[model samples]
Target: MLGKAWQFARRHKTKIAAVSAITGGLVLAGKLAESKFKQWQEEETRKMLEQIKKQHHYENTEKTSNETLKSLFPALIKTIEKSLDSEPILERIKNQTGNKIELWNELKVLSFARALAMIITGTQLVLLLKLQLNILSGILYIKQPSQVLSSRLQERFMALSQNFISFSVPKICEQIREKMIQLLALSLKEKFTITQLEAFFQTTLLQLDLPGFQKLIIAPDGDHISQPLNPDEHLLLDDLINNIVELLEHEDYAKIFRIGLQTSLSNVFDYLAESYLSHESYKENGLRSEVRLPVAKLIPILNQSITVYQSVLHALIKHYTIREYSANIYESFCQAPPDAIAKPSLSTLWPF
Candidate 1:
């Protein structure tokens, strides 16, 4: 059967070749046509995209110019009003200069002058808007100039507010401290002797159990100086009490008290100075300098406040420690000493 089929195929070989050639040609033509259609579609899409981009650019330019005109309109109106009023000044000048210019002639001249000024002002506004629009669209890809301008204005306003706050907080803190000192003095009827106050502060610091109280210097990172006391540590409590008592015994205790407090106050003053000076310099020079205005003003104030807050907490702890230690010592010492008593129990011997 295979031999007979091969013989029949060979007998119609010419006809088979004709059909195969026609089918292959049709397939090749179809592929070429499809390729051309695809290229045409891509070219059409590109043209459409270019057209859309051009239209968008035109609209942006138009919108930018319109906004510029709107912003300038009020100022332009005011200028015109001022120029019209200046007719009197111009006439007075003419009279004073002995130019023999009539008031009515001057009025007509001022009217023409005001109109010309308005036209010139309008043209200038349009030109400025055009330039800004071109710059934003070409360089910055900003579709709306007004939005960009508004954002810039808002940022400047915020910076100004931050600068004000940074400078004012230190003065405010100083005033509060003064008031507190006065109140403390008033509450204590008896004059606080330097020695007695020193004792009081020493006792307080001992009771607070705060770390880094004896260290006069603060670290730049602030974290090392501001850590809180460990409540579970009995040794910390004893050291805190001992230091407070020692401090109280010092003759110049008032001057040297609250080491952390002094560090904090110094930090605050330094910060305020840095912030104010930077703000002033920024106004004088500009923001284009090596020292960024925000950095110069913001960093100092933030770091100062953080250190100050830590110092304040440490000072409070010291105050409480002193008071508690004083109370305990007074209670224990109210009676005879353990050695003086005939037979003291272990509990009575260590009145901790």
Candidate 2:
């Protein structure tokens, strides 16, 4: 029976070959199409993941996470509190200024502002990235394989030929080849500004000198002030301090920083203290009284400023670490599904 069936198939070689070719072509095409579709899907998934990772890295540091935050917060708060020991300085500022109400009021405002800024900024940074991740996931997962293939084939084959016969086997195959190229190009160029912004902020933060608080401020000029040991000293200090400010103001960095300021009081105080301390003349005065002016009475201001600065720095580090962990969570969402749907099939040319 099998031999007779083989002979019958052989006798109708042209028809058999055509049918075989069609069958084989469909199977091969289906597999190839499936593979290509899967590849495209995976590539899209990978790209989205990379974007999420980039955004994560940018908006939040590697250190930001609940576990890390939990571990670090107590220690950080303790350190800041210890450094701030406001009692001695508060008394000094009150005695020297004789305007206790005004001075304390200003310190109170500054402290409050600082805390508010850090909380807000940190929250905004984390939330902004989270929203971006959600948007990206929706875009990546919403696509259907059949729809994509149909759309692609239509755009390619429709433009080439109108009639069925003109759409020869080889020609149709050629069209698929062309469509694949177009699809690849489109996928590669897809925009993700959130990722870009995140990357910018992360890179900028990495470049900042977090511990060099004293170097940021320059001392007021005086005959007693010591000259720079080297010719490059002034330039070095200027570059370092300028770099920090520059990083803070960068489009992406500024956006995250502003958001972070809104989330945490520490962040706001950090910004204020850093900005004020970076001035060249402030360090020169050394929070002391001058014969020409009673600015010496403002020593409490300097002390309070330092305390706020320390507190903000500690808080930022803690918050940053937590954000880093959150970014990792966003990254896990990028993996491709295992049981994806089947690809579309092409109808064959047959006589009615």
Candidate 3:
């Protein structure tokens, strides 16, 4: 009986343990499913509430918008009726504007009344200007050109010229010199090519109608022509014009041109010196020799180039009117001696 009980206990104990594990797993799965279903129901309830709230808000907005449009509809209809009625008003306004425009056209830019107004205005202006003359006469009286005021003005003019030479003219001269030199260099490079020079000589010396100067030999004027001449005479006559053209084309003539260019270029030194020496600053600085040396150096470069010579010559020469090197930097400024000297001397030069 004890052995049977032991065997029954062992077999039943294994079955009991397996049944308990299965029952526990089923209970856990049921609890998990219930929790998940509750969570899904709550989420669905929240989404449905959000959708209902949005729909309600959208319906309210649409109802308000419809009410506003209904409120404006009568005003819109009235505006349309008014616009439709304005066509005659528009036409009448256009006709009135056309009439006004014709009347305005008849009114000229100037007439008797305008001229009268202008005269009155000019007279008032002249009367107002008299105040300036009166004030000036009271302060700085000028009865005549020999008056103290006139003398003062003359002295001021001289001082102004001096100041310009001392301060302004140097810089102005530097700019002008730079511009002139640059223009000269460019003109030389462009205009004075050897090819152009040859063409110029050919045009000037060799007549286009008679390249061989046959007309000169034959005398187209029907005068001073020795007809039926000897062979030597014919040879001399025909050869004379050709000989001159040949001589002109000679290398010796080119050498002569170079020599002439050098001589003329050398004269430029005197010209520049004369111009520089005209300035009071040059005399004070004693830069005459300094100026001449540089000019002498520059003249030789011209000898090496006929282009340089012609360009400089072109810049120097004038037609109809003559030009002199006169600077007017102080034209607008009246520089009394005291005013010129009173200004800070260091103001002329600012160091960076």
lDDT per residue, candidate 2, 64-146, as tens digits? 33333334334433333343334653666747856764545444433322232223322432333332332233223444524
Q: What is the C-alpha lDDT profile of model 1 across 1-352, one tens digit per residue?
A: 9999999899999999999999999999999999999999999999899667755755564455455445545554454444344446454655675443343334333332333233222332232233233323332232242422234332332222122223322233233233323333222123233234334334433443222222211111222223333343334233323333343343333322343243333433343444444555556765423233332223223322332333332332234432333223222232323222111121332122
Instruction: Please give each candidate's TM-score.
Output: 0.33, 0.28, 0.23
Candidate 2: TM-score? 0.28
| Tens digits of per-residue lDDT for model 3, 57-145 | 43443343234333433332232223222234335445775564333222211111121121121121121122122222222211233
Over 4 Å off in model 1, which ranges? Answer: 1-8, 11-15, 80-101, 139-352
Candidate order by TM-score, decreasing, is 1, 2, 3
For candidate 1, the per-residue lDDT at 7 reads 97
Pick out the ten consecutive residues of candidate 1 with the lowest summed lDDT: 214-223
Pairs of colliding residues, candidate 3: none
- Which model scores highest in TM-score? 1
> Which of 1 and 2 is ahead in TM-score?
1
RMSD of each: 33.9, 27.2, 44.8
Query: How far off is model 2, as Cα RMSD?
Result: 27.2
